[model samples]
Target: MALLHRAELRPSKLELLVPWLPGRPWFAGEAGAEVTRVAAYRFDDPAGEVGVETLLVRAGDGPVLQVPLTYRGAPLAGADEHLVGVIEHSVLGRRWAYDACGDPVYPPLLAAAVLADAGQAEEYFEVDGKREMRPASMTLTGSRTGRPVPTGPVSAGPVDSGGTVVRVGEVELAVVRQPVPADVPPAGGLTGTWPGQDEPVLLAYAR
Candidate 1:
């Protein structure tokens, strides 16, 4: 479960992403188009120190683009090259955002979602000393197509904004950056549903 706060974010996620999206080689969205959030989902950090989020956005009428991010109070050592940007959180103070594919916390969790059937974290709103379950902007479902359970440390290979493949002990999980209708979603991955979307779309797959 993840706790949420109704606080302001300076240079919001979209603000940060718009400037960075066009630089990515895999960015297929229209150039110079305005970006807007479509939906988002979170995965919890067992230690409760890092914030894990996978955001979906669209530029103009272009296809949805996926951006996985991790937030930390302090810079992650040895990950300076992967830094997304810095932002100020009303309650959390300064936050360092990084590309989730480079964050050490992401691969294992993603692998679990693909192999162990781990789903998105449950979120709660925290304000005025009261807690209430917050409705998800989107829902996530993990599926494993009869693959053997995962084992050992998880590590992600070269990441492609188009699709990322992370290697677990013996299984390889392919995370889809854009849910296209043409590509067939393979077994053993994750799917998601959000407002205005008629059907659950494949978010990742394992083979």
Candidate 2:
């Protein structure tokens, strides 16, 4: 389960992504186009220290883009290159967000989700010391049967229009940074759907 806080974020997520997305080789939008968040999902960290979430955004009429992000109380050691930017949290003070592809926590948890056919984590908000369910903005599903891959440090390769390959332990996972066209081959791993979408959209796959 993931806890949701009713906190304010300075330079909200959309603000951060607007500038960051265009720099990514896989980003399909115009460099300075307006970006809007379409949907989002999350994964729970067993230790409850890191915040794991993936956002699907669209720029104008462009295809939806998948961007996974990790939030930490402090900078992740050895991952300066992946830092998206720092944000001031109303309740937590400050947070450092990084590209999930470069954060060590994301790959293994994603691998476990794919191999175990797990759905996105359940979210709850604290109210008077009691937890109440908070509906997620997106629905995510993983494949039911796949070989369990050990999770480990992730090394991200150069991203291109096609996608990027990251080595997670001994497993190689391919993240589809851009939306897959209708004629494209079916995704082989986790998928998601949002309001008004009847079909599951590919998020990532194990290679």
CA displacement after TM-score superposition, residue 51 of candidate 1 (Å): 0.3
Q: How many steric clashes between backbone atoms does each model show?
A: 0, 0
| Candidate 2 segments whose C-alpha is farther than 4 A from its true place | 181-187
Lowest lDDT 10-residue stretch of candidate 2: 179-188
Superposition error at 79 for model 2 (Å): 1.1
lDDT of 2 by residue, 1-207 (tens): 998889999989888887888888888876777888888888888789999998889976788898889999999999998999999999988999999989888888887766666778898999999999988897767776656667666788667887777777887777788745332224347777778776877777777
Q: What tens digits encode model 1's per-residue C-alpha lDDT throughout 91-175?
A: 9999999988878888778877866678888899976788899889987777765666666666667666668776767777777
TM-score of each prediction: 0.90, 0.91
Cα displacement (angstroms), candidate 1, residue 183, comes to: 7.4
